[model samples]
Target: MRQLTLDLQPAAPPSLENYVSGSNGEALTALAAWLAPDNREPLFFLWGESGAGKSHLLQACAATCSDARLDPQLASLPTSSGLWAVDHLEALADGGQVVLFNLINRLRASDGRLLLAARLPPRLLELREDLRTRLGSGLVYRLRSLSDEEKRAALAELARARGLELSPAVIDYLFARVPRDMRSLTQLLRAIDQFSLEHKRPISLPLLREVLQTSPPT
Candidate 1:
């Protein structure tokens, strides 16, 4: 059989709406509800396990808001503010959370919006007093991990977007034969893309399995 080929150049990151649509169903719906206009200016906390798409949702919201071309001042900080996306709120240390709380408070008083993401829920965050209080009062959303079915669907979608013509049989084979998490799946896909370019071979079950066996531990 003739080998299928895919152009391997990178594309811009997928939008949050599209990324959520491709995520596990529950997360997509819950995020939509939390992001609606009726909820605007209400604090939104997105908590999830790693690889659960919180970053994607945050970036998407930022991108969508940026695209609206609202006054640059409004979208920016200090002189202006519209939307604020604080990624990895869990990484904040010392009095950082309290500072964040003040920022959010000011934005909200001015009728602006704030979106925050973290690996754990806000109440559990080891943060400063005012920050903890603010987080507790916010509308929290969880981005759940993908099921096996959702994982397969997501991988297939990624392959298509990358222009790789893969069969369900092949996708299923890799899903079972290798590490099945989204991160590993993406790593495997990129490796295959590189391998195809180097050896000029199409992505196949044999090629993927070989790559898996020989690849160093991440």
Candidate 2:
């Protein structure tokens, strides 16, 4: 018999320190406290639109704990210690809903913590009433997207982290030409960094245009 093997690429590890709080400082603070080892809350639900960094925060929380589980498929809840960080709660099937509902009940009786992320709030999710109510029982947060200025600041911070000194004019140039989102901006910044490294050149307007024109928009 032949054994089947599957190759999977590990996702980049996320950390609370790498996250740019922007306008969501309060939300960040609350999440940091909830993710702390000493948090008393048994459950937390975080809602945000696409690209609002819910996944990043969830993964970050999971990374902080040794026994944490992140993005586990909900056919049934696995018995695990420490925090359980579940993403895409809105897509849970009927069986998953029942399992989560029961898991929440079990966690309520123990020291384990739950962190859930979804595109919509529990009241609006297509889930069992009991499960939805349980999910909403603890602290609920709505993650806000960063503003344009905040995005620029985040890009500048990222550039600095990469040891690239970007001037105000260069920042403004990238902001005007690149997609006005953190994900896209960060990807573009990386591309620029790679291009500069390959060409042995400094990041300037000419190099920025060369990279932008040659590469597809992120």
Candidate 3:
């Protein structure tokens, strides 16, 4: 079976409103409250597997408040702004770990804020014990992947909103054949919409297979 390309098209901009929390609703709620201008929380760490919406939530906060975003590889983190976001912490270098440790200390001293997302939880992170403890010191939230039923409901809503019709069989075909992440599924749906329009064919399993054929092999 041919694989469909999901990353070619950029996803919709990440935003708090667009994120589907599923079982992680409580995490989302706390994040929203933390992003409030008046809130004084020092830091938050979101950890989960890839495609679990960790990046989305952090970016949503940064975009919503114009906060500085820190790179995982940066050794010299910014000291100008109290608000900062660091993504993909698993790739951070040792120098970065030291800088971040000090940065966290300062954030606590000044009541500044930091946002972090990683593939692992703080206790399990391969970093300095102090840094790991500092990361876990804040309100840590683990993002949960959406279940098939939740994804199906979201897809149905997306199809309805776009005035596109997707049969249950096509959706089942997608779940079985393609990546299960919401972002990828959404991209697939868009690709199918465009392909159906171009070929003047009804959306169907055969058409989906045809569309999948157009993407280069993985």
- Per-candidate TM-score against the hidden true structure: 0.67, 0.80, 0.83
Q: lDDT per model, in order?
A: 0.66, 0.76, 0.80
Order the numbered candidates by lDDT, best leading: 3, 2, 1
Model 1, residue pairs in steric clash: 74-81
Q: For model 1, what is the C-alpha lDDT against the true structure? A: 0.66
lDDT of 1 by residue, 95-129 (tens): 45545667777866777777777888877877776
Clashes of each: 1, 0, 0
* Error of model 1, residue 44, in angstroms: 0.8
lDDT of 3 at 65: 29
lDDT of 3 by residue, 79-118 (tens): 7576888888887777778778888889867878989888
User: The CA-based lDDT of model 3 is what?
Assistant: 0.80
Query: Which regions of candidate 2 deviate over 4 angstroms?
Result: 1-12, 63-73, 213-218
Indicate the residue-level lDDT of 37 in model 2.
Answer: 76
How does candidate 1 fare on TM-score? Answer: 0.67
Leading candidate by lDDT = 3
